[model samples]
Target: MDNTGFSLASLLVVTALGLLVPLIVTRIRAVRIPIVVGEIIAGVVVGKSGFSIIQNSEWLQFLQFFGLAFLMFVSGLEIDFATLKPTKVRKGNRYARFLTMPPVFATFATGLTFVLSYSLSQVLFNLHFIKSPLLFSLILTTFDWLWFF
Candidate 1:
């Protein structure tokens, strides 16, 4: 194929690698790592940072977008919204029930996370490990929700 055109062989290779990563991860029982982590490492090895084996193409970009959307959709499906309903708190005022709601609790937890992250980031900044504590804290805080799904 021409230099500008996409190759089907490259797509096949990517697909095969994607399928093989999980199997490889499972086969090595001693080394415990998430499949997603393994896949990311494999991608880095094959991508421009390592070998430049996987050429960027329109079809690959489209597939990447679709895959991300599908992953988010599947992750969102795991949430149990029904449990988010407010529950009664005995011997408390009207606002107590509202405080018991999952969103309120989540907000409180997020705030706590930001506070902790900011403190840690401040230490890192003092040590010259990072430039901006606020930005680093924000990044760390943002990743807190990723574990939920």
Candidate 2:
């Protein structure tokens, strides 16, 4: 009821949104959208930006931190460290072998993602779709990495 205190109802609403948005998005055969993106849209619609239905509080902040930690832990568990180990090249030249390494490939892919994201962000900024190119690029880069994991 109070502005500064915790609300169990708000927490329940957030949990329901988190569960339902992904289900709804997946069930829609015509519209393609990532589950995470759908959850974010729901959050923006219900939070202060749209209807001011969920007010910020210390409990919600703590839950957010915990959720992020759990996500990172799950991602870490999904990693196959065996695939990351470099294998010996029997015949190729040094440059060819180096490029074949998993770590090198991953690094190259990540760099390419950042470069493309920055270019697209610059275009969006010029069109007034975004305010800051660099910040948007960084956010895009982070999103790409998160989605990859």
Candidate 3:
């Protein structure tokens, strides 16, 4: 589009509306979900798929990167390191098992994914169906979260 598409007014209005949707949805029905979900949906609506408010601005890219970094920093800040102390604090046996379970499950999933991808790659390569194993590896890694869950 043109410079008129990325004007300050458009950005501010889109951002406000994005924030407002989740607020209004949660307030009206008394249900709760993350604000980030609303923000992502609003982004899709205002993106090329919908109204096309902003079109690939460099400033917006930079701001998105900075926002992600800031969120990670804030998450790290909230972690309670003191709770993990062995002498000063006591933890139930279940806490240790719970912590180990997620990692174990993740490890198993990663290994299974690798094995499946490798077997598929071998069969496809033998049949001349696919050009490269690297391409198959990339496809496996690019799985959508919605599909996995």
The C-alpha stretches of model 1 lying farther than 4 A from their native spots are 1-3, 25-38, 92-99, 144-149
Q: How accurate locally, in lDDT, is each candidate?
A: 0.83, 0.84, 0.67
Q: Is candidate 2 or candidate 3 better by lDDT?
A: 2
lDDT of 3: 0.67
lDDT of 1 by residue, 85-110 (tens): 87667876767776688899889888
**RMSD of each candidate relative to the true structure:** 4.0, 3.7, 7.1
TM-scores for every candidate against the unseen true structure: 0.72, 0.73, 0.47
Error of 3 at 138 (Å): 8.6
Query: What does candidate 1 score on TM?
Result: 0.72
For candidate 3, what's the RMSD?
Answer: 7.1
For 1-149, candidate 2 gives per-residue lDDT tens digits of 44578888789889899789988999977767778678878989999889989877778888778878987898899899999999888895889899889999889887888899999999999999999999998888777444334
lDDT of 3 by residue, 1-149 (tens): 54333456555765687668877656744445456655677778887888877666555666678868987898799887655544422467865555455455556677788778878887888899888976796577555445223
- What range of 10 consecutive residues in model 3 has the weakest lDDT sum? 82-91
The best-first sequence of candidates by lDDT reads: 2, 1, 3
